[model samples]
Structure formats: structure tokens, C-alpha cells
Target chain A: MTSVLEIRNLHVSVADKPILKGVNLLVKQGEVHALMGPNGTGKSTLAYTLMGHPLYVVTGGQVIFKGVDLLELAPDERSRLGLFLAFQYPVAIPGVSVANFLRTALNARRRAANPADKGIPIPEFRKLLKAKMDMLQVSHDFAGRYLNDGFSGGEKKRAEILQMATLDPEIAVLDETDSGLDIDALRIVAEGVNKLAGPNMGALVITHYQRILNYIKPNVVHIMLGGQIVESGEADLALHLEERGYDWVREKYQEKAEA
Target chain B: MSEQVAELEKLSEYKYGFSDNVHYAYQSQRGLNAGVVRTLSGMKGEPQWMLDFRLKALDIFNKKPMPTWGGKISLDLDEITYYTRPSEKTESSWDDVPADIKNTFDKLGIPEAERKFLAGVGAQYESEMVYHSVQKHLEELGVIFLSSDDGLRQYPELFREHFGKVVPPTDNKFAACNSAVWSGGSFVYVPKGVHVEMPLQAYFRLNAEGTGQFERTLIIVDEGAQVHYVEGCTAPTYSRDSFHSGVIEIIVKKGARCRYTTIQNWSTNVYNLVTQRAVVHEGATMEWVDANLGSQLTMKYPSCYLVGEGAHGEILSMAFAGPGQHQDTGGKVVHGAPNTTSKITSKSISRAGGRTSYRGLLKVYKGATGSKSSVVCDALLIDDKSRSDTYPVIEIDENEVTIGHEASVSKVGEEQLFYLMSRGIPKDQAEGLVVAGFIEPLVKELPMEYAVELNRLVQLQMEGSVG
Candidate 1:
């Protein structure tokens, strides 16, 4: 089966500082890949680089999604091509209401997909948005407020998942969506992801804790240290890392790298 | 009278020079002076009191040198055409207004707007008001809606008491000039406890070449009255620099709530210098929503004097300066009474070598306790050549007051641009979106049509900007 995404010998930098060195990653369709990395490692940098964040420059490497080279494309083009990324620390944009923003994004996506698409009619669009909000357990009032302005941590996380459900990107890069979420919020956000997941969708969930993985139950767990993944296994790897901590893995990776 | 040599020269630069051919018995010859002032007053058949006021203002206008404290005004008094009346006289009905002048307002979408939404409408064409009227109920409610000149004529006692009282004639050169040569503006008096459900609107257009619009608008919201008045202006772009030195004064009597909004998109060749001030009495609230789009150089700072305890004032301003334009605008708030409050938020976007400045002042009097003021000014520079500056002065004499101010100038961050573009917005559109979002507070204050036009003007400024 063709992989949903292919990253070959990825070398990236954050603010001129060398971070991800020769990192190779791949995720198959219908699968969830968990990335567990230590603090100060290149976890978020890798995720941002994949999304083509200008701050994270790709010095050397190629990111191929389906058949297209992702590095050559812009973020919105990638987004239109069914790529959505929920940031670890999402940006808060004041004055842009969630309803208007979602409408613009969804309409832009629909227009790109169907040449003659008129975009969603207002009544139908509101109805569809209402049904999705019901599934996510979010209030209808959230739509009218400024996009993520003055929202609490748990609310922001749920809002991110709400966007993910709305956009329905093909390959989503969840950059620590679990961060700052309480247990209830974690389960709710995870439930949103599970409900949206399907055969055509692939997800790369980057996290530091085993708590979120308990709900999503990833197909594969990759442990990252010193900017590159050195070990890969089933979901059990997360439980082991959670129990033993990242220090043991770090020490063993250093020993093996030296050898 | 000092000659308007600059005004005549600028009017001479107006290339279209399209005269719709309206015959008039009298008009000011090409520029301003005591002769022009006397001619204008006599043309209106004014009483001696008004004539004396105009003469006093004319003397002060000549004596008061141009403001040197702030922006470069450089207005050549010689070039300004003091008066350019498009119609023979002001009219009281839409049908009575002349066709040539009617066509101008028709193209600008005023009559249709009045029929659809406004409670009343005032249209000023060149130097005089062409039409002024209100819905029947408002007129029956004792709301006196008339032209400023007519107001002075009809209710001289009322006009004399409040006129230039809030923003005195001695305030500045432009105010004195507006006081002396003031022609047509709105005269609104909301009676006590009456809340105007619909917004009253005034449309000021400078269609004539090389002219100065010295419209003096006076609004007095009596005790506990609530009113929202919106004003908008536009001019055909010309090569010669015209002048707009208008004065707007609002007196929110004790316990009244008044909101004065202005969306100004004058032509590029107009040098806009306006003096707008409001005095809020006990428990009164005043708000100013200002948006500036077109001008060669604009120096306008809408201010509020909180003279009564528990009074409050707010100003939200948005400015977009493109090539060959300088938007030197901001706000001022004076907390004169105990427990008074004020808030000022200014947003500016400069592109294509355009310049924008936030020149503001916030003051708390010596004995005003528990006064609070906050000023936030943010500027977004689209490219390298554009410039944004902040000059804020905050004086707090009371130790119990809470005053905070923040100002920052930021070029569009590459990360923000990339994040937006990665979402599929093109580079130029992305920059425009950031700017639109940056000034969203002010944009949200505009009416729908004006908001759309503001966005389009910002987009135009963004054209060929992103490399």
C-alpha cells in the first residue's frame, strides 16, 4: 500500500540552529503514528517543518505526501490538498470569528475541490456546523466569538479539534494537541479525532505523554532523541516509555549511536 | 483677509473641472478672506451677531498661526477656495434639490440609503447643504435637525450657547477658520430621556475643485438622551491639494450617551485638518469611531474632555496610508472630574512609502481620583519603505489613577505570512488579511459598505507591495 506521507532523510533548522538531522519518517493511510520525544528535542520543529512554517527552514530533505512534494507547496495549498495541522501551542487571532473563519476555509476547500462549486449555502452550512458541534460537545455560541481570543487552555484544545473536524484534512500533523488539556478535555479531543479517523485519513500525533495515546491507541509508536527517531514499535512502546521515563531510552540510544 | 493663494492654485489643479451648470447669484471668488467671509455671511442673510462672530473668527483665523506642535500642516492659505456652492440655495426636500447636485449624491448612494435605513439624512455638496430633513416622528419628538447655518439663523440663542463652547474658536487655526467660514453641517438636539433608535447620518462631499470644506457640526444630547450619529465624506481625486479644516463639537449633557462616528475617505489631494472635541458631563458617555483612507496629508486628532464625574469616553480609529499619503491621526482624552474614564485604541497600516503616526494624549486632572485610562496603538508595516511612529503623552496627577499605554511597530512577520499562505491565501492576500485583522477593531466599528471600502483601500495599498 502507498504510504500516506513519506519523509526521506529530512534535515531541518529552527532559527538557524541545526535541529532535525537526517530524520526519515513515513505514515500509512488509516494508521496513527505516535511520536514520543524528550524535552528540548526537535519534535515540534519537525511538525512545523512538515507544515512549511517559515521559521523552521528545511535545509535538506524531501517531504512527499501521497505523490506530491510537500516542501514545494504553500501551507494553504497543502491545506486545500487535505493537510491540516493542529499546533501544539495554537495561535490566537482576535476579531476573526470562528464562524467566518470556518466558512472561508471550508468554502476555499470546496471551491478548490469542485471547479464550479458555489460553496455551502448559509442555512445548510449552519445546520452542518451545528451537527458537527453536537458531535464535539461544543456550544453553538463558540461560532460567534473571536477565533480563540480569551479562550482557556482546554477550550483552545477543543477548538483545535473542532477545526480538524471541519477541515477533515487527509494527513493531519497533531503537534501535541494533548498539551494543556485536562483528562475530560483530552478524552473529548481524542474522541473527536477517533470519530473523524477513517480508511483514507492518516494522522501523525506528536505527544510527550502516554495519557492521550491511551484513547487514540496508535498503530505505531516512534521514540525520538537528539532530533532523530531511533526506535519504533506498537502502542505498547508508549506505555513502556511512560513507565520507564525517557532517560533510559536516551542513555541506550547514546550507547548504540556510539557503537 | 489673508489670501487663499494655495487654495486657488489647488483648485486650478483640478483637471476634470466639470461644471454641472447650476446658476448661482453669489459665490466666493476662488479663495478665502474677510471679503469672502463677509460675502458668505451676507449671502445667507445672517443677523449682526453672526456677522460679528464671523469677523471675530476671521481676525483670530488670521492671527492664529498654523499649529507647529505636531505634524507638518504646510497649508498655503492662499490656495484654498473658501466657498464653492453647487446649488443656488439649501433645500428642505429630496425633490427640491437640483438634478446636477442630485446626480452627485445619487452616484454616491445617499437618497436610497436614507429611504432604506437612516432615520434622517443631510447631504452637503461643496460649500452648502443641498438637502436636510428627518422622519416625521423625530421631528415631532422636538428633535431640531437642520443645517448649521440655518440652525444659527433659526435658533441663534441655542446655537450661540453651545457653538464653539466644547471646541472653542481659540482651540486651533483650523477651528478658528471653521468658526469664521463655517457653512453647512448637522445640528442635532436630542431631548432628555429620548433614545434615538435609528442612526442619523450626514454625507459631506467635496466635489468642486480646490475647495475647503469648513462644515461646523454641533450636536447636543440633552440629559439622559441617547443618540448615534454617523458621518462620511469622499472627494474626487485631484492633483492640486485641497483643504478640509472642519470642526465638530458634541455636548453630551449630564447622563447622556452619544456616539459620533466618522468614516472619512477624502480624495488624495486634500489636506485634511479637523478639530473634533466632545465634552461629557456627569455620568455621560461619548464614543468616536473614526476611519481615514485618502488624503495627501491628514492631521486629525479627535479628543474628549471628561468634565463631569463618572463620565467616560472612547475612541477607536483606523487609518490606511498608501503612496503619497500621510495619515497623522490619533486621539486625546482629558479626565477632568473625579472617577472619569477614557480609552483610546488606534490601528494603522502603511504601505508603498506611506507614513502613519499615532499622536495621542491622556491626562488626569490634579484631583480626579480613581480615574483610569488605557491607550493601545499598533501599526503594521507592509514593506520596507513604509513607516509607522507612535508619540503618546500620558499625564496623571492623581496617584490613585490607573493609566497604561502600549505602542508597537511590527513588519509582517515571515512566520505569520508563511502560516497564512500555507493555508492557501496568496502572499499579497495574506498580508492584507493580517492588516485587516490588525485593524479589525476599527473596521468592526464601520457600517457595512464603508467597511468593505476600507478593506478594498487596504488591498489597493497592498498591491505590488509583497515581493
Candidate 2:
């Protein structure tokens, strides 16, 4: 059975100002979707709202994932249900090693799935971490570093992808993961995401550029403007938007409102 | 009420609140006087000179005024019972100890820790040491480990030579109080060139109500010797506040090294004011690792007097202040000799309307050229109602000295919390992890067992902190 995320008329407000105004979209397992928009177009807001950030208050919305309303769950509960958000600016947690944090997160998910589960054994966890690090081309020493503390921009982005690979979420939301990376770092991170996105996993790639879309091919493309997804089409639509930009879309929406 | 406040209240419950019904061999009359001091010394069978010393200390206690700075003190010194001895004499074997006293120590895991890693153990109840033991090999190595009273009687010459040399009775009001009514603390003497690989631990338990615990500890590490000493304290809860004022003095001889670690978790109804200082000789080192967790109010600053050239001192201090608690703690270092070095690092956490302050002092006297010192204080406030402060005093008369001080105050950021929680950790655990990370540097300095226990205690304090 395939998993589906149905976001219908989602309205989210931050500090009494609406950022996501009745946005609607659908993503399914085994498919990669690209969400393209300019700055302040609610692309990040939609991503944060999907992951249940406390600051993004839902004024009106229904985000149904696997037939359950995602809006009613806590962030941890959403994560236990296999939802993940690769933050654009991942915060630093000083003195917490990446391996320790991953193990804790993995144990939390495991205990939620089965209350009797103790935790991943140390040797087993080491093996699993080594395998995932190898696949992502991340150095073994990366696991020993404090999570994102004093990390460079590229290291932080790669850390996010490494986390995504280890968690293996069913529906992953990559929110501007390519923003801070250099070309080499971007290819490494993009390739990591590609390796993790499989038949059992789905991804919503949110970005403002078409450069990352070249590496991680998306089957469906959606363009967001002024707090809503106004246009969506095949993967070629991202190429079209790259050439024409959002000016034409803004003009079309203004014409519709005036009529 | 908000869920956060409710959770904080729930987490503030004291786990070591249970009391035991023990038959005290002798209990002193409530309130303090010169007669009480005389009777305490007489009961200990101390010599004439020691009695005269106590009398002088009692006079100083009466003349000195209460301190006007740091946390507010509501202690009614006149109403406190100054002495309560649970046993007639210290027991060398655990089985010889009274069942009730042994059970109390058992509950606190004193014996278990001794068997696991400690080279010696001292279990104190009220104002007397009830159980004491040292490993056979350590005893064979000419190490002197005994109760302070026994040290006075058995090693009189050595005890008299070093007793008040480091911390005289006139050091502070509390030090005077402790000198006048001191009892039950450990006396350790490591001979020349001998190194004790394992730690010697002392656990103090205050089971009675409205009583004062004055344990005066003295340690002397001879030339080229080394040892590590750890002390832990806890008390049963009571409506009226108890008092604990201890004075610990150590002398690290030339080329010797000594470490003193303290994990103080007294009941919330206790006033803990302790004065600890060490005199480091040439080429010697002294370290103080102090962690303060539970108390109504605490004002303690462990100090090191670097009186010899090339001596070194280090202090790692941590404090946790919960509801209705105030912890004013830090360290002090005096560079009195040339080329001396010192470092003081302090970490404090305040939650649920609690308050913590880091008050430290670093002083370099004239002619103490090339001395280097740095002080760092970091405080974490868990809630808006909690409070933290840093008071760092640096006085340097030497123009050639180097000094640096850094202080930071941080709250658990919402972004960090969201990041962790979004990875499947719950809110409270996420906060606990962040706090654990905040103190990781100091925790790593502790022994494995102590580091683990400190982390567990921090987690317990963080429960329901986020709602």
C-alpha cells in the first residue's frame, strides 16, 4: 500500500500574519515533487507547517498523512509517523555528537513503534552508522563531531542529508537544502538524497533555483506565489519557470483577480 | 497555571526526602553557646590546646557579623541544635555499625561505591563518623585515613602541625562556626612519593531535624605524593531548615598533587555554607571539582592559595538551582608566587523560579610576575522566572601577569528544541539533552560513575520543564 500526503486549504499564520493562505497540494510515495517559489512566497512556511512547528499557527487546514490529520500531532509524533524536515538553517547543539543524537532519535522512533523495544545495541548502531556514512560519502569522523556546532555551511548541509539518510523517513521534506552548499557539496548532498529516495520513500524538494532539480529529477513541479500554489505541471515546468521566472505568473494572477 | 510551571513543580520533588528513626547516642541542647563548644570538645576527649583553640574560635563566632552579600540568609543560628552524634565510636567494619545507620548509608550506595572504585570510604551520620574503612593495600602503603577525631588522637603531632595552618578560624564567620563545632570529617595523609590510584570517598547524611553538621576535613599530601578525594552529602527533608557549615583545608607539599571533588545534594531545607581552601607548594597542583544541586541556599567558594613558585590550581564548579533554592557558588585563586597559573570554570542552571549566581575572585599579588589566569562562567536559564548572575573579580598588582575572563548567559533556544523534537525526541528529553550538552565539558572531567549520576540528576530536574 502506497502512502499519500494530502494538504487541502491549509492556512497558517505567524504572529497574526498569514503566510500560508489556503495552500493545497498532494505528494505520494515513490514520487519526487519540486516546490518552486521566490522569496516570501510561503515555500518555507508550508514546509515548516507540514512538520508542525509551534510558531506556525494553523488558522484553517487539513494535512492528511496516511489518513491521519497531521495538523493535530506534535512534532515528535509527526516524526514517529515517518515525517521529516531538513531545515534550511539547522541549529547547533553544542557537545552533542552526531552519532549520539542519531541513536537517541532512532531509539525514540523504535520505542514509539514498540513499547517493549529497549534500544539499538551499541555494536549494531555502530555498524548501521558506518554503513550510512559510507553510502553518503561522509567521513567517519563526522559522526564524532558535535552536531552542527562550529560546522561550515557545507558541513551543516551534509549533516542534514546524513540525518535524512539515517532516519529513512517515509515522506521527507527538503527545505532549501541546496542553499548553503558549494557546487561540490551540492552534488554530494543531492546524490545522498537521491540514494535515500526509493519506492518506500517520497520527497518534496522545496527550492528557489532549478540547479538542484537537474540532479534529483522530480516527476511533478509546483510553483507557489503569494502564499499559495498557483501552478503545477510536469517536471519540464521547472525548466519553464527557470527561463521565464515568476513575473508572468504574477501578471496572470493579477489579471484573474482584476477580472 | 501553565503546563510548564506545573511540570517544574512536579520535577522539584526531592527523591532523597525519606527519613530514618535512629536512636542518637547524644544530642546537644538547641542553640549555641561557649558551654556547648566546651562540652563538644570535652566529649571528644581532645587535649588542652585543642580546647583552647575551640574556645578562641567560639569567641570569633560570637564577634563576627553575618555576611551582607550574596544570597539572603534567614538562618536562626540560635535555634539550631549544633551537635547530634549517632554512634559512640566510629566502626571499622560495616557489620559492626548500627543497623539503622548502616541502612541509611546502604540506601545512599556508599558501600557499593567503595567496593566498586573507591580506595577508602567514610560514612558520617549527623555529627560523627559511624563507619570508616580503607583498603588493606592502601593501609600497608603508610597512608593515614581516619576520622578527624582519630587523627587528632593517633597522629597528634602531624595533626597539630597542619590543623589550622591553611584555613585559620578567622577566615570567615562560617569558618569560625565550623572551627568551634567541627566534627566527623575525614583526615587523609598521603606519605612521600606514594600515589593512590583510586579515589577516597566520604558520604555525609543528616537524618535529624533542625541540626547543624560541621565536618572539618584536613588533608596533607607530602612531597611527590598524589591522591584524589571525593565527598557527597544528602539530608532528609524537614519543615524547619537545617544548617551545614564545613571547613576543608589541604596542604599540597612540594611536587605533590591533590584533587578534591564534592557532590553536594543536601535537602532543600538546609543552609549550606562551606569554606574550602588549599595551599599549593612549589611544583604542586591542586584541583577542586564542586557540584551543588540541592539546598535552600548555598554560598560556597572553594579557593586555592598558590604560595610557591610554579604552582598550579584548577576549579571546575557546577550548580543547579531549582524552585525556592538559591545557589551562590564559584571559585577563588590567589597567585602569590611567580609563574603561578590558575583557571576557574563555572556552569550554573536555574529553573522554576530558582536563582544561581557565580561569584569568583582571582588575585595576583606584587612580584608575582608571569602569572596566568582565566575565568569562564556560563549560565543557563530554563524558564523566564528563573534567574542567573555572574560576578567575577580580578585584582592584579603584578604588571607582567596575564588575565582573561569570559561569561555567557543562554536559554534553551526554541529553534534548537524544534530541531531535536522534529527528529522524534520529546520536548522534555530534548531540553535535557541540550542541558547535558551545556555541561558536557565539566561532566567529562568527573569520574565515570559521577558523570553518569550528574547526568541523571540533570534529567530529573528537566522533567516536565517543557509543556
List the DockQ of the predictions in order. 0.41, 0.77
- lDDT by residue for model 1 (A41-69), tens: 78888888888787788889898987899
Fraction of the native A-B contacts that model 1 recovers = 0.44
lDDT of 1 at A118: 90
Q: For candidate 1, give the lDDT of residue B403.
A: 91
What's every prediction's RMSD, in angstroms? 5.7, 6.7
Question: How high is each candidate's TM-score?
Answer: 0.85, 0.89
Worst lDDT run of 10 residues, candidate 2 chain B, spans B115-124
Interface RMSD of each: 2.1, 0.5
Q: lDDT at A229 for candidate 1?
A: 86
Reference contacts recovered by each candidate, as fractions?
0.44, 0.81
Chain B superposition TM-score per model:
0.84, 0.85
Candidate 1 chain A lDDT trough over 10 residues, lowest sum: A250-259
Give the Cα lDDT of each candidate.
0.76, 0.83
Candidate 2, Cα interface RMSD: 0.5
Give a tens-digit lDDT track for model 1, residues B175-282. 888888888777888999889986776642222111237778899999999998888743222222267788899999999999988877665657888998999999
What would you estimate as the lDDT of candidate 2?
Answer: 0.83
Count clashing residue pairs in model 2.
0
